[model samples]
Target: MSLRSTMHIPAVPAFLDSVRLRDIQLPLPAAPDPWHRLGKPQPCTASLKLSYSSAIAAAEKDDVSLSIDYGKLFRRLETDVREMAQHTSSPEHPHHRMVSVEGTRREEMKASAVGQDPRVTAGIVANCGLSLLDETAAGVRRMSHLRQSPRNSFSGSQAPPAPQPADAGPAPITAEYGRCEVWLQLPKALLRAEEGLKYRSVTVWGYNDEAGADALESESRSPVVLEEEFRIEGIRCYCILGVNSHERVEKQAVIISLGFEGPGQLAWGSTVVDTYVALTRAVAEKVDETTFQTVEALATFVARIVTVDFGNERVTVRVEKPSALPFVQRSGVEVTRTQAFFQSHEVAHSTLATRGEARSIEVLVGPASSLTLFRCPKQAALYPLEEPFIVQR
Candidate 1:
């Protein structure tokens, strides 16, 4: 006899493909040094997570040319950043060249009077991680704006451009009295890999002005602004969960990952610095005591803390169970919610966790079959209401 208990649980598509680049150093010029001093190129990190939208036809058909080479993507990012940094955003005072390491040559290349302009400096610095977005990878793959050389892009027979005069120098780039604060999330990337520039520039710059240099972005709009994207990856915790009797008594490991966007950039006029360590600590500690029965409740609780308690404008929370299924690697729920979303909807934050009782979200966990949300209202169109039905871990 067959195990006739498998429920027809409808779920989101699984086993999606993604290409990633982790810990790539982004050289930030005239930014704060490790010692808190200015006028140095502080090296920062950027990570990319590009997921496949279509059926990943290249992999299915066993075709090499149809696939996007990770190596080419890596090289393209490096080249585009270098080219962007080398050029001034404005056409009025153009002195496009690479920022070098030599001490004195940097000084000579800087124009004293103009080097003080924060707008010009921020524009150049922001461009390092900034790019436009499109609906498909074809948009980026076919663009010629970011060619190896601007002049030679048109024809191979063109003469090399003339050299600049000794007196002509690059614009002023100083991190002394001001800074160029921008947060472009590769996490900000959407479905398809489209755009010649290969990325989208959302203005996460802390600067008060919304119409700053980042506004120059063309094409599609980002899901959120470009202020700093905060994250706490690999949050491992043990919690009681499941429908089985053994699972009710024992605790199982759950993996959680969270991402958020902070408020506007404000210059902290102090010697010490602030960080997301507190936010991470707070979320982990609260989630540790959580005894939710389903990954859905756990994920929603995490999103609530980040958006309501931590004051983040928006948050994406993912909670996964490694032991939920016998053959499957993990079963999980991912939810994205905003501060405004919670304010208007009371049910968004009504699930309370107390020391007195055991509780789990009233969710449907049937397998590959019809789904019925026990507690969700018929009109609930909010994120977690009809959340991506069990996005695989």
Candidate 2:
């Protein structure tokens, strides 16, 4: 049976265009803290003996107090560094590392480290000692003059060196937010229809705080870092919009659809899905409850559908409800559907086409499900010519 040209679909609201979108998926089994997970917990104690020289050894017996919670210290340092990394700075600005250490023991250590020799300072800095090696080396050099002065007092003669220039290379991209990685396939029919069309995909990685974003961006060489650190997964999806005409001036309504894997984190998945639904609804309200949808809205929708990995070029969509499962464990549903199902619906129209033919074609390719609607008469003709065209069940 032939398909009906126009159907009464429920109206979906439009969304704010300012929303961020991403298409990359992260891996799982993130890195564990070596010090916390593997280090042996031993009681910490230290005694200080100060002598001007062996001949002048002070007769005063000195008692020193020290206590260490190695695991807590390491965790605090890790969290601090991660937070510092999240600060957004132009590649030109110097990124400051701020830390807050409380408790009497930590306070005492900080006091001892202040204006002290590099070795003493290094010991007090906790887990980030290695990362701060360069700064520590510089600090040592600055303080060296104090040891050489006639009175053995800090002279403060030299000003610190200027901050280094931001690296000239492209910023490193990492999967610092996601745990799993999934692939998506474009239906054969959609592939043929959008053979040479150009579409852009963007991924914006956000964090609980600005600091988190900075940290992830700074450490990320790709999206994989998020998976490794957070044990979260990632997926790639495409936004297939059905525009009525190619003319930039023409305003036409388009159908919007998304293709993606099952949701990753249950809370995150629900939040993303709700956001997507809201954006789609808003766009539908703005354009004809039938036509135009922003790329941002569609991208946000697909971001929530991450479930499982179907290997290379297989389409999968996921839905998660962490709170819905018994015992409140991490849980979600993954639904696998071929790209062919989505491609049949996304249609594109162009003004450049001859009366009976389409002017141009654009296809949405990725791991998620998307919609392609026909906007112009010519597009309507080209929509069905694709290989693996959809067969209405």
Give the runs in model 1 whose Cα sits over 4 Å from its true position.
Answer: 1-125, 128-229, 261-275, 340-350, 355-393
Measured with C-alpha atoms, the lDDT of residue 70 in candidate 1 is 56
Compared with the true structure, the alpha-carbon lDDT of candidate 2 equals: 0.25
Q: Ten-residue segment with the worst summed lDDT in candidate 1? A: 188-197
Q: How accurate is candidate 1 locally (lDDT)?
A: 0.42
Candidate 1 per-residue lDDT over residues 16-127, each given as its tens digit: 4445566666654433232334354444455554433332555555644444465665565666445543443433322222121110012222332222222233334333
Q: Report lDDT (CA) for all predictions.
A: 0.42, 0.25
Q: What's each prediction's clash count?
A: 18, 64
Please write out the lDDT profile of model 2 over residues 1-393, one tens digit for every residue: 111112111121121111111221211111111122322222211111111111111122121111122344344344532332232222221211211111001112222212111111112222132223223333434544444454553445655444446652212111222111112111111211121111111111222232333454353212100110011122222222333223221333222333332322212222232233233333233222111123333322332222111111222333232333369554444444443433343331121112212233344322235445423332333333333332110
Candidate 2 global TM-score: 0.18
TM-score of each: 0.39, 0.18
**By how many angstroms RMSD does model 1 differ from the true structure?**
20.1
